[model samples]
Target: MTLRSTLTTLAAATLLALLPHTAQAAEPYPDPRPITGQEIIHDPTVSRLKSGGYVAYSTGGIIGARLSEDGRHWTDAGNAFAEPPAWWYEYNDKADPWAPDLSRRDGRYWLYYSVSSWGSNHSAIGVATSRTGLPGTWTDHGKVFTSETTDTWNAIDPAIIRADGKLWMSFGSYWTGIRMVELNPKTGKAIPGAQVHHLATRPDAPYAVEGPYILKHGRHYYLFASYDACCQGVNSTYKIKVGRSTSVTGPYIDSTGKPMLEGGGDLVLEGHGRYIGTGGESVFRDRGKDVLAYHYYDAEDSGTPKLGLNTLRWTKDGWPVVL
Candidate 1:
């Protein structure tokens, strides 16, 4: 160790310390819980039936359905309706309905769904009721809300929430992000003349945010929505984001205090590993735990859309984490 060499070594160490340190790579996201049997699904909304087992309704086949006795092993249960209603053809020439939401209230199961053609804003959300929440038992109740090409908002993706003792439906896609309108609880229909409230959107064109689901946790209402592109299978870029507000109809703010209406949301879940394009989410309670129901494109299965479920846990600071 010559003195010159020691001095040179010290100088190099000092220079190394002065230079910026390399950032450590972030941890990869956890994969969805493995599921089996009849997992093919898209835009799935799941509910734990009062009669035991779970039923999921999604976008396809007059509102395609899947049933699970244990919430892990699912089997195809056919479609919600044997045939689409005559009015459905007004929006969708094929009479196809998409994104059915099911909830139980007052001893009856209420279902809300949307009908529309691809890339069109002329859409309608309809309501139905069933005694058992089964696929074929639902009785169509006609349109609850609608949006035309002239309207700024597109009406699809119906999500119902009872906040502040009032029923509200949050729905929208692409045209103007997410919007909400009050509903008549008795009829499970939109209240005539009720004001439409805007909840979330992006700043740029083709706003990219939709599939809004609101969950009331503690005193704050959390708004969860899918962001970015969808339906491209392996290329789909869909992911889930969330924001929270003190009011049901809000200025919901993200973790950084950015309002949801201004495109601010905290990332809750995203595609990672074999799961790609994870979105189209809904929350359901089962056996005292809040579960997140969503669909992900499976890379291992050649980008097939499949069911994904996670236990949604809340942090000490109130943010949600999917596990």
Candidate 2:
């Protein structure tokens, strides 16, 4: 590469960092090789452990765990939560953990995950409790939520957000739209008989929205979601979007006030270079910095989905720009 080309690339990056609304052009991020047992690591949900280090979780194929001392280079801890929990024998023929959301609350690390089956929405989201955010000592809370029928929208990809002094969960994608329900402060279970409020999507162009993560910055509540084809090798077109509302059970709308129920989204990151099908986002605020965690299939790595972490910054005018 020529020096001039390098200078051009650096200038472009600078411009992106300076601009807060539109995303910065995708560049080669920190690709720490020997990301130790991070094989096909997809559906990333990250949390900063109270005792320092970061716990990053993923689904399917071994159900792995990677610990990052500095929120970057990971030391593989092997499979943390494997499937075939005997619950699968009672339900689906196979057990696939969809997405796991990690949070520290009430002096314990609560890990909420799901179980899935192919060709059916007959699924369940489960929870596990850990005193230390490491492998071992995880107490299972089985079947947090499940589908009544195989055809109805399945409950998976759980993203728990605490708003208005209560915990809310957003779960669902195809078959039915995304909905939010309050969880009991003690057990983190949905308040009994509390009808979940519908949040986004319409009958037309449903787009199969899922992976909802909320970030409450300043006074606005931001709802970030992923839209379209996931899990399909290189043919996927998954992208992330965000909308905000004053209330947790929101009629979330885009920057233009267009309802997410109306199928409106502002794109944050998409496939670039050898990366394709970027989606499955998890957002959190840490140490005055907002972090976005998601997965992208790296063609350079033979379409293997690898975990990615990027810094998120907001505009003076209230737009979230990915750094």
Candidate 3:
């Protein structure tokens, strides 16, 4: 080749090397904007509707709801129900709901939420459906699963996902770690004959793990859970941790190759500055980015629990890291 052509090719290659390459998946997680209007939401989960609007459901009276046009600025969307379902009062004194998981299935929105009093294992997870993915429009489907005081596992903080052409749910807290159960796709309820699968937990004293959210990315199933004490505002110690496995029903392990059942997890996010105790995480794949939406106590805002959104990126090494 001519010297001039060879030099030109070398120069082009150098220029290409100098430019930053775009990532194949996940953006650098952004600092969440100060969302306004009824921003106090615990255990927040987001869903983008077909009409291009975003809906967030959380733990509170009538099951708190919030709406966002662009997934940043939010406004109160009212509650999912005008009154709590009759069955809820049986478990929770005031009938308040908690840790709602929202998803779209078969052209409809199904919300799985929990009902229980503080520090009690007597909890129930219920489903409510809506065609519009809005508050008020949801039709209650009563209790889909329940945990009695006699049970070893606390059945709250339920999350659902579709895998292998079937619906599956991961729900549990404190007592025996996380558990999964298959759901009948048509009914959005437990598949009667299917057995509940135990997934992860901290076997040590105080246990300290809950809020199971499973997502399928590439060839692995990522299980995200919260560790340490929550609900204490600025004093809260809650943080998000994760593990992964090839099978949806997993023996998930962290980056250190430690099994999650033995109290192992990779830290995803924790308190930084004004954001304290970030936990109750749910993953929402929006547009082309994976958004990790959760709630964190705002240290500066009288320790009020508020919505948090960050991009969940996967490292080239195949581990999830929050930016």
Candidate 4:
């Protein structure tokens, strides 16, 4: 295996303990040392590269890159990937290539991102391939799935899960709910005959629910997603929610046996203290359980949206409580 694969094993050793589920929320985790070269980057996806180097990428509206040696302390921030497709700009004017999911498979790095405005159905998911996962080296594959201006939910926040030897992607929000499609391994394209499922939606959810990430525990495929507003300062209402299914294209259910397809979500994290708007999550299941990585308005400082990392533990009763 490579360095990233080795460090992924090391990260698994650092899994956090599962705790009780409470709506009142947490007492805050003690500050850990800053993982360097990762300054100002938000919405982080952590994984090991073939070079054995740890690579993390995020949506600063553009891809940001950093290297981690011990999988904790990182080196300087490196080059972000290039924006894909020439016509992607026709819809999005300001270059909001956000929320990149970096996956290393078959000796290449696949960069998937949402290219569009927020909260609108006029969004699309696109792919670009890079041999080295370096700066400006992506080979664009154009659009993967489009959810723009239709009855369909918005298509963004792409995450690829490999199961039973097939590649699948989970994406959607807005009028279009969270959904999934099978992917072609060689071309990184959706298999033409694939169908999209309406995973979850909440018209009364207080706000739009977006940002879906998947993890595995025991026999279930865990669907972890953020709900409500993401970028508000003091009034931010973001929270993490979860559901699970036996398969990736899920009719995922929550702790109450309520289906996520019907908008029932188990609360995982919410704002407390000076920290507000605590969701926009991408969960990392390093060792055993899950650890969450997202951005929040800092409680103490300027209340600026800063990077937040915490562990999500399963109670003895089998529900995830974010700490």
**lDDT of every model, 2 decimals:** 0.90, 0.75, 0.86, 0.72
Q: Report lDDT (Cα) of residue 87, candidate 3.
A: 89
Name model 2 segments beyond 4 Å from true: 1-39, 82-84, 150-152, 202-206
**TM-score attained by model 3:** 0.89
Query: Considering only N, C-alpha and C atoms within 3 Å, which residue pairs clash in candidate 1?
Result: none
| Tens digits of per-residue lDDT for model 3, 7-117 | 999998886544322331233334665566667889998988888889999998799889889777789878989988898889987998899999998989999999988
- Score candidate 3 by lDDT: 0.86
| Residue 14 Cα positional deviation in candidate 4, in Å, after optimal superposition | 22
Model 2 TM-score is 0.86
- Residue 304 of model 1: what lDDT? 94
Residue 218 of candidate 4: its Cα lDDT?
A: 66
In model 1, how many backbone clashes occur? 0
User: Which ranking of candidates, highest lDDT first?
Assistant: 1, 3, 2, 4
Tens digits of lDDT, candidate 1, 1-323: 99999999999887654432111014366677777799999999999998999999999898999999999899999999998889998998899888878888889998899999889999999998999999999899899999998999999999999987899999999987999999999899999999999999999999999999999999999999999999999999999999999999998998878999898998888899889999999999989888998999999999999999999877757878777
Q: Write the number of the candidate with greater lDDT, choosing between 3 and 4.
A: 3
In model 3, what is the error at residue 31, expressed in angstroms?
3.8
In TM-score terms, candidate 4 sits at 0.82
lDDT of 4 at 112: 88
Better model by TM-score: candidate 2 vs candidate 3? 3
TM-scores across all candidates?
0.91, 0.86, 0.89, 0.82
Q: Is candidate 2 or candidate 3 better by lDDT?
A: 3
lDDT of 2 at 178: 77
Cα lDDT for residue 18, model 1? 47
| Best by the lDDT measure | 1
